[model samples]
Structure formats: C-alpha cells, structure tokens
Target: MDEVLNFIIAAYPDDTLKELIQIKLSLDKTGTVQVSVSNAGPPVHLDRIPRFEPSAPTESNLDGLWYFLAKNFVDHLEFRNLGMDGWQAVLERRLSAASFEPRKADSEGSIDEEIAQFEVRPGRHDDAAELVDLTYDTYGYSYTGPDFYHPSNLSHHLASGEIVSIVATADGVIVGNTSISYPPETPCCAYLGALMVKRSYRRSKAIELMISETVAPAIGNRP
Candidate 1:
C-alpha cells in the first residue's frame, strides 16, 4: 500500500495549457529516504492580490480585486459585474403600478371645459396595462410601450391593496390621472408619485380637483 497525498501546483499566470508533474524520492546508506529538492516550491505573496487591498470603490474602480496563495498555487480574481436589466424591470413594474397619465382633447382655456368627470377611488390595478398605455399616450411619450408586466415578477402591493387615485374624463375619455401610495406607515406617512396629465388637459381647476380627490380620502383614513 502507498500513501495518497494532495499538493497544489503553481504555474506562471501567463501560461496555462501545461500538465502538472510529481517528483520521486531517493534512498540513503542508512536506509533513510530524503526528498528535499522535491519538497521545495515557489514562495507566495498573498498581500499583492487586489481583493485583499484597502481601497474604497469609485465610479471608475468599483471592481474590487483579490489574490490567493494555496499550498503551491496562486490565483488572481476580480469581481465587478452586475446586471441592469433586472433593476429596470423592477422600476418599470413599479411605474406601471403607480404612474398615471391622462389626456384631454379640447383646451377650453379654463377648467370647466377640460374636466369631464372626477372620481375619488383606488387606481384600477386590474386594468394596469390599459391605464399604462392611456397615460403614455396622453403624455406623448415615445416609449417602446409601457414597462411590460410579465407574471414572473408580479408585485402583490399593486395587486392586492388599493391606492388612492383621481381620474378626470374629458369628453367621455379619461383625460387626467393622479395616485397616492396607500397603507400609510407611521400613522401619517404617505407617498405620492407618478402624477401626470396630458398637455391638452391644461386647466387650473382640474389640477385642483385631482390633487384634492386623490389625497384627501387616504389621509382621512388615518384619524
């Protein structure tokens, strides 16, 4: 029976496509075996590796570096790649849930002609896709379309809970939109976002109606 041993073999980082070899042993007159030359290997300086350094990340050098010294091998590695697609997906989905954009047809130069109707209620989550398009179309925003809400990352808040929404229909079409984040934390904390109306919806009083209708009800829920 022979002894099984494991050892690390270090090669110059510049070259890789080589095989690792093991050295043999020799015997002396006293029957003692020696393997000094075979045991000697290269010295490792672990501190030189970039990963273990004391440097803060910058916009340029955000990628941290690292090096290692194994039994007989040295390794250099770098880690600095993150994906933005996932983040954009999240942002778009959130925008879909919160953003509201309504368009108006005729600019009557006053609030009376613009506002077709006003409603104080939650934004319709079931029709988010349609609302997203309506909002985008009203604003004249040239996007590929709304951030697609695929089922893979569907959010519950936008689905289960309701958000305060104000809708103004102009000439039988929803022309203005507003929304407020609900389920207030800290008894009075509310978030407002994604408030938009089309250029054609330029009426001073309509803005007041949207602001009042969307915000007033939720705060009333507090006390």
Candidate 2:
C-alpha cells in the first residue's frame, strides 16, 4: 500500500498546495481483494483507463512502471473518472479458494435505523483507550499495525500532528474510526489511513461517513 501510494504522489505536479487522496481496500466472499486509490485533483476519462495487452515484464523508464509490474500480477486493473467526485484506479486480485455466504439483504431496514444515530467527529485524547480496545476486539492482536495496540502511542501521534483521526460514535461511544496522514515529502498529498468499525456497526454508514463527511472535509479545510 505504501509503495503504490508513494508512486501516485510522485506523479502529481509540484506546484499544487493541497490534495485529497483516498484509498479503499475491499475483500469479497470469493476472496478477491480490491485496492482502490482516488484523488480529488482531476477526473480521468473512462476511455483513458488502460486497455493495452499484457507485456512481458521488462525494464522500462515509463512513469507508470509500478503500474505495469502490478498489473501483471493482479487479476484486473482499471481507471475511472468520477466527474465532480474525482478519479479512481482499482486493482483486484483473488486470494482465497473457499467461498462464504453473502450478507443477507436488508429487508427489515434495521441496518439503516442503527446507523442513523451515529455521530462523526475528530477524535480526542480521551478516545485513546476505546480506540485501542476496539482494535483489539476486532483483530485479536493479529492486526499488524503496532500503534493501534497502544493507546498512549495513539495519543502521542495525535498530539504530534502525525495523524488526524475521525471517529463515529453512538451515545458517545466510538463505533468506527478512520484517519488521514500527510507525508512530509509530498506537501500536496494526504494518505487515508486504516478504517475500522465495531463488529455490530460494520453494516452501518459509520465507515463511509467518517471518510466522506468528516475526514475528507476536514482536510479540505486545513490551511
């Protein structure tokens, strides 16, 4: 993820003062993994999404050499223009052989009812404990990110301007969280960080709102 993001940042023009970037990782029951990167700079037309035949892996000087090497391994790669929304590149790969049952359709509308009450806001110092607990509950120590395992570390990072966290709460309890980080070398770019929602709140808009309504808008307002 870091390698791909850095390459994307390098492609941006040097004069831009601000940028909005989003990365989404999705996994389906059939075990296909998709990584999407979107930027709020320009809309790339659908016709511009690469459609060239695969070439043998070889040395090249193209700016998109990383894309070439990656496209060779991933099952699918495509780009899309989102009009007013921005541009996106999606890469997909199948990783699992076993399939699981799909989620049940929302017939009773309970999922909507539950998410309607979520409150999104920037995270605070006091939110550290709950954030760490939530991470543990979700990943059971298997999560590779070490900072999330320590509340003090999270608080420190939040204080040092290393990250900005947007959290979704229900009745004042954090139910979902996401973050944004600006790479020092890329002043015009910001990277989307990890997003996690409580098991019970996974079906809600808590994740979406944290990114779209809170985090992105907050970064846009930065000086």
Candidate 3:
C-alpha cells in the first residue's frame, strides 16, 4: 500500500497529501494485493472559465484595456511614480533618444527560410485579426493607450498608407506583426509599433522574420 501510494503521488503534481492519510491493503489466500488511495484536501475542479467570450472579441478594440492596467499603473502613478507627467516626459525623452543597437550576428536571418511557411504581407487586412489577438495574448493587458494602438487600427494605418504594417502567419496562425508609421509632418523619422509575438512562440525567430520582411520593406529598407 505504501509503495502504491508513493507511485501515485509521484505521478501527479496536482495531487495533495495530508499528514495523516488512511490506506488499506488486503491479501486474499491467493496472495494478491489490493490498495486504495485518497488525497486529503478540498475537491479538485478543472473547469476552465470562458474569458474569451463574445464580450471580448465582439468589437474591434476592447475599450477597458487602458482602464484595467491604469487601475494599477496610472491610479498609482502619482504614489508610485508611474505614468506621471514627469515620468511621461522622461519616457518621451528616452523614446526620442533610444537607438537600435544593431549588433548583428554579422548577418540577418533569412526571412524565406525562417518564416518560409508563414506569409509576410504588406499593409493590413482582415487577415491581421488573429495577429491582433496574438498581441493581446502575448502582452496581456499592456498593449494599449499612448504606447501603441490596437492591431486593427494599426492595419487601418497600413491600408491608408498612413503607416506600413507587416504580419507574420505560420500555418494560418498569426504569430507576430511589425509596423512603422511615418508622417510627412514629422520629417526626421517616425515610430515603430505593434512589434509583438506570441508568448509560446517567442523562442522561435518569427519576430525577426516579420521585422525584416514586412516592417523593413515598408520603410524602403533592404535586409
């Protein structure tokens, strides 16, 4: 009985044990073993709450995103120094000064071979819907407000030629996207946004591929 309990406990990490557990074992005249096992804890439930209901995806953009994160970020921005005017000024200064530290492996990865199965498309369309979903999923609640626009809005910018957008799809799943918008009014440069990848697929080289193929070309760049 002890051996059997040990084996079962080793099998499931979610299983619980109490300091005191009752185990019963019996042997008939034939010398066969019978064992019983029980975990000492509240009943376990594996039901998943449906978070991605119709409410989540019914509209183009989820409105409460900034509100949700602001519950922590901006709400305490004054107390904790997040999103404050000074902080915003500091970040704006940093964003203005930040440069791409282009430490190449000396060579860029091949977009064709790396993202071969994935299609790199110009501008934005209905196809980018899933990439938007991937963005929310990857960054959770942070992909909103002044830092970036919603994925679909980014697509609109791409379609209008207001900005350049590129989305990467692998086997029909939108894994990542890259975008940069240049306004003629702002002559020196523009901003890059919507650069994201799914959490599980981040280990793969998908983001680089998308950047090289979609975003790089949109800005009249050559990799």
Candidate 4:
C-alpha cells in the first residue's frame, strides 16, 4: 500500500485543506481493498464542486487520477516524483489522447535556445485574455476559480494590487505565467502560486526565471 500512500501524498501536496480531509484505506480478510476520502471542511462552494471519482483498482487510470486530484483539489498543481514510471506513462498517454500540444524540444535545439526566445516580465491588464486562454488550455473546465481564469477577475486583482502576475512571452505570445498573492494582514509574507508554463516551454528554465526575476522582485518590493 506504499504506492497508494505515495499517490495520495503526491496528489495533495498542499496542506490548504489537509486538516479538513481524511483518508481511510482498509483491506478485508478476503483481500478486498477499500478507500475513502472525506472532507470535514466548511461547505464547498456551489461553483467549486469536487471533481475526483475513484478509479477501478485493476486499471492504471491516469486521467481519472489526475482529474480527481488536480481539477477537484485546486487550480495550480505540480508534481516532482520523477521516479514513478507508472504515473509518467499515464501522463504521456493522457496528453497524447487529449492532443495537448506542448513545445517541441527537438526542434528547439538546446534548453538555452528555447529560453533565449522567451521573455519574462510583469503582467499587464491587456494580458488577461491570453492568460485566461492559457488556463483553459491547461486545466479546462475543471478549474472554476474566478480569480485567475476570468479576464475581468484577473484584471481586478491586478488593478487592486492584490496579485502580482508575471507573464512569459515568446514571440509576443503569452506562453507561461505565475503570480504572487499578498495577504493584507501579513505584510512580510507572500504566497506564490498560479505557476504554469506552456507544455513546450516546460523543458526550459522558465520556472526558474519566474522565481528569480519576477517573484523575487515582487517580494523584495513589498514593504
């Protein structure tokens, strides 16, 4: 059951609702396994319904696994467990089936070549439409969050200075994005979230660039 436990841990890295979620796994004398997930948190909002449906044990249903954890849990998700071949196979199959077009590494030569064509800078209100499209392309309808996925909502957040968004543009097209959310009560601390890069650019140092160039500057500028 270590694999199952690892899956859960990898699925829900953020403890945002950790204390509110409980997981139970049981195996009877007959060897039948049962898994249960319960939410003890406050009532879920109408627009933010959970999207996870448990998959049958016999099949390695990667799409079901990702839908449950990524779409149902939160808008932004990342996984670093590179050694899990099973999970990786699932991702490859799913992305191919969905016709997800990520940047082609073979055509781009080296990582440096790819990074050279991309530019990262503070996001503008005009970027709201492209950013919304990027989120929709990445997460689809599963991400119902109004903050970043909606153009008007993103513009409001940007205008109010509640969120500092950094956008990556390749050939004048928005391809990668990340943001830092500042809590009004905690002046010194900022929550870095909404990090996403187009599948094609993921092989490059885009994330590192966002952290070092955009996120760091925003946090340092906070008073």
Candidate 5:
C-alpha cells in the first residue's frame, strides 16, 4: 500500500502541487481491498503505462510505470473523469479471508521518533524572510511562482490572511513550511502549496505532519 501511494505522490505531475493529491483506503469483511486516489492532473489512461523504453519520458508516460506496478497488487484499475475537478484512479483486489496480511509495525525509533524533534505551528509575518530563504535553498530560484521569492509580498499576504502558512520548527529555526490559498472565484475551496522541507529534515515526516496534523485542521476551522 505504501509503495503504490508513495509512487502516486512521487510521480505527481510537475505542473501540479503535491498537496492537491487526495487518497483513500478501505478494506471489507470479504477480504477486498480498495484504494482511491484523486487529483487535479491529467486523466489517467491505462495505455500510458510503459511497456518498453521510450524516446522521452514525460509525466504521462511515467504514469504507465505506476499503473504497471499497481497491476501486481490489484485485480482491477479504474479511472474516472471528474470534469473540471480532474480525475480519480481506483484500485481493487480480493483475497481469501485467511490470505489477508497484517501490516508490519514500524521498528522502534523510526518515523515517529524523527517527527518528535520538530514542532508545527501557524506562520507569522516575521517568518516570510525565512520562508523565502528555505524556498531558495530548495528550488534555487526555479520555482514557477514568483510571489514566494519576494519576502515583502509573502509577508503582506500572510498578514492579510490571503495565504495561510504553516511552519515546522526545530530549535526555534524553520525546517519546513506549507501554505494554503483560496482562489478568488472559488472561495469555498483552498489550494495547498508552497510545501518545502530543509534537505536535512526531509526524513522527519514533516510534510505529512504539516498537512495531516496542522493544515487540514486549520482548514476545518475556517469561517
């Protein structure tokens, strides 16, 4: 399950933010497993899975590889179009009740231990400069969005609530950050982006904690 889900995030289209990817997993008494992944990217096509090497590997072509890997664990893969909302991919498999395997527990001092070292909180106006510095270190001025590079702009947005920022800190220094913004036309829905973690801190599960623990809860409290 982690293999398929991790590939889904890693292979997410460069044109879209990873924050937009949504995942759901379920298992039934009949020993059927199901996974649903939804995102605002190109439609999923089973034919896109790579059968052989190609001249160039675009994002769409690489998807073929993900689908191919999924085929090993799932009996069926279904793609559903959601109009302007994008698409969803559903994977399903069935097994004898006795064939189900329990998930392996994490070893001591693994991700949980690493995550305990940092703290997540809402970002302040003063954090703009540090956030910009972190972005520069990660994207090297190549991030497509120009707003984040300007500390003044980011500060203004943060102060005005145009952008809701979350930061993960260790020893009072920022190690990771993410933000949410609402589209003018779609105020009911928030777009999550600008997620970045210090190269040295990527293993701390800061990204997962920021989104699942902080961002989602903050969004729920929105008026």
Candidate 6:
C-alpha cells in the first residue's frame, strides 16, 4: 500500500493528494491488485480520460509497475526530479535504446537559398511566451507531454541550460520551433523534443532548415 502511494506521488507530482476524496486498494490471494481513486474536482470529461484494459502481469514486461499505472489511470505521467534511482536508470536505458543518431549537416554554401527567407537561431529567454503560443497553435490545449508549455517552466529550463531551443521566424513572427534537452547525468547524449511548425508552413522545409542551421551547429558545439 505504501509502495502504491509512493508511486502515485511520484507519477503525479503536480497534483495535490489532499484533494483526493477516496482511495481504495484491493489485493487478492492470487496477487492481483486493484486501485481506485476519486478526487474532489470538476467531473472528468469522458473524452479526456484514458481507458484501462487489464493485462495479466508477466515477467517479460520490462517497464516497471508505474508504467502500467500511468497508462491505465492518468492523463499523463512524467518522471522528472523524482529521486527514484532505479526507475531513472530503467527509463534512461529505454530512451537510449530508442534514441536517434544525430544527423550530419551540409555545408552552408551548398544549402537551399529558400531557407534564408526564414530566420533560424537559438532561442532566447524572452522567446518562452512565443514558444508556448506556438505550441498551443500547433497542438491545442489537449496536448499533454514532457515539453515545457509554460513560459515560467521554459524559462527555468533555459536558465539552467538544460535545454537549447531553436526557433524559425518569418518576418518577425515565430513559425517553427524545436528543442534538444540534455539529461544532466548523461554527458554524451541529448533528447530532441517539442518539434513543431505552424500548419500553413509545414511543407516549407522549415524543419530541415532548423536541423541543418540550428540543431547541427548547437550539437557540434557541445563538449
């Protein structure tokens, strides 16, 4: 029971546990366990809720218990700044195995001239709000993931140098953005995330331009 509570706290760090109206846990003699939680808040919209399908636990399931819990019960789950060493190692190993190899860049002189119409550069602290607005424009409010969608969170990441962002602006309006974040403990690796482009410009080769002009240069500068 304590383990389950700890797992909940770890998975939903942003939620207030005190607001939960009820929590029920049941474990049978066969080792099958069930948990139900009710929180005092606005009723959850059905479309927003994640459906859970029961699966018998097996030894071959490499993802820890938290994975199942999050997939079954939560809208989203993120494991950041949680001091669970073992879980972090498992997550890192899984991510590293699936990581893409950084691509090489072409010489500037050989690149497409059309890319010059859009400015591609490293993002600044002041760009956080614009970045969030770009995200909303791209994915809408229902988008839930690890990307920092708020200016304050983005600012914290930028200040810490944990993330390096690249933005593409056309005539002073941001139309595209992407970021690569370094895991503090992983010196040789970085995770690329939050790649987005306004719908009208999706076919403009903006992503390729950002990768060539921004991502490649930034990654090369890393020690």
Q: Best-fitting candidate, measured by lDDT?
A: 5
Report the poorest 10 consecutive residues by lDDT, candidate 3: 85-94
lDDT of 5 by residue, 1-223 (tens): 5645665566565754534878897887678888898877656565555652355666756746655566666798777898888777788888655356665543422444344578888888889999999999778888766778999988987887778788988889998888777556787887777678876666677887787755364453465
Model 5 residue pairs with clashes: 49-64
Estimate, for each residue in 57-85, the C-alpha lDDT of model 6 and write its tens digit: 55554335544565445333332222221
Q: Cα deviation of 214 in candidate 6 (Å)?
A: 4.4
Residue pairs clashing in model 1 are 50-65, 51-65, 51-66, 102-175
- Please give each candidate's TM-score: 0.35, 0.44, 0.40, 0.45, 0.45, 0.45
Give the Å error, residue 122, model 4.
0.5
Tell me how candidate 2 scores on lDDT: 0.71
Per-residue lDDT over 176-218 for candidate 4, one digit per residue giving the tens place of the 0 to 100 score: 8887777668867877776777666667777778777763633
Q: Which 10-residue span in candidate 4 carries the lowest summed lDDT?
A: 86-95
What is candidate 2's CA lDDT for residue 114? 50
Model 2, residue 55: what's the lDDT? 59
Query: Compared to the true structure, candidate 3 yields what TM-score?
Result: 0.40
Q: What is the C-alpha lDDT of each candidate?
A: 0.40, 0.71, 0.49, 0.58, 0.73, 0.59
Q: Which ranges in model 6 have alpha carbons more than 4 Å from their true place?
A: 1-116, 141-147, 214-220
Error of 3 at 5 (Å): 49
lDDT string for model 3 (1-223, tens) is: 3333343344354644442344444433343433333444332221321222334554433432332333233212111122222111010011223334444441344244444466666645554457557667667668653323365665565556656667677777776777666765875776677677765556667776776775343254412
TM-score of 6: 0.45
Q: Model 2, which residues run further than 4 Å from truth?
A: 1-116, 183-189, 214-217, 220-223
Query: Which model, 1 or 3, shows the larger TM-score?
Result: 3
For model 3, state the Cα shift of residue 14 in Å.
49
Count clashes in each candidate, considering only residues at least 3 apart in sequence or on different chains. 4, 0, 0, 1, 1, 0
User: 39-126 in candidate 2: lDDT tens per residue?
Assistant: 7665444344344334543333344455656667789977777877777788889985756776654343345645369888887767
Q: The CA-based lDDT of model 6 is what?
A: 0.59
- Model 3: runs farther than 4 Å from truth? 1-116, 144-152, 184-188, 214-223
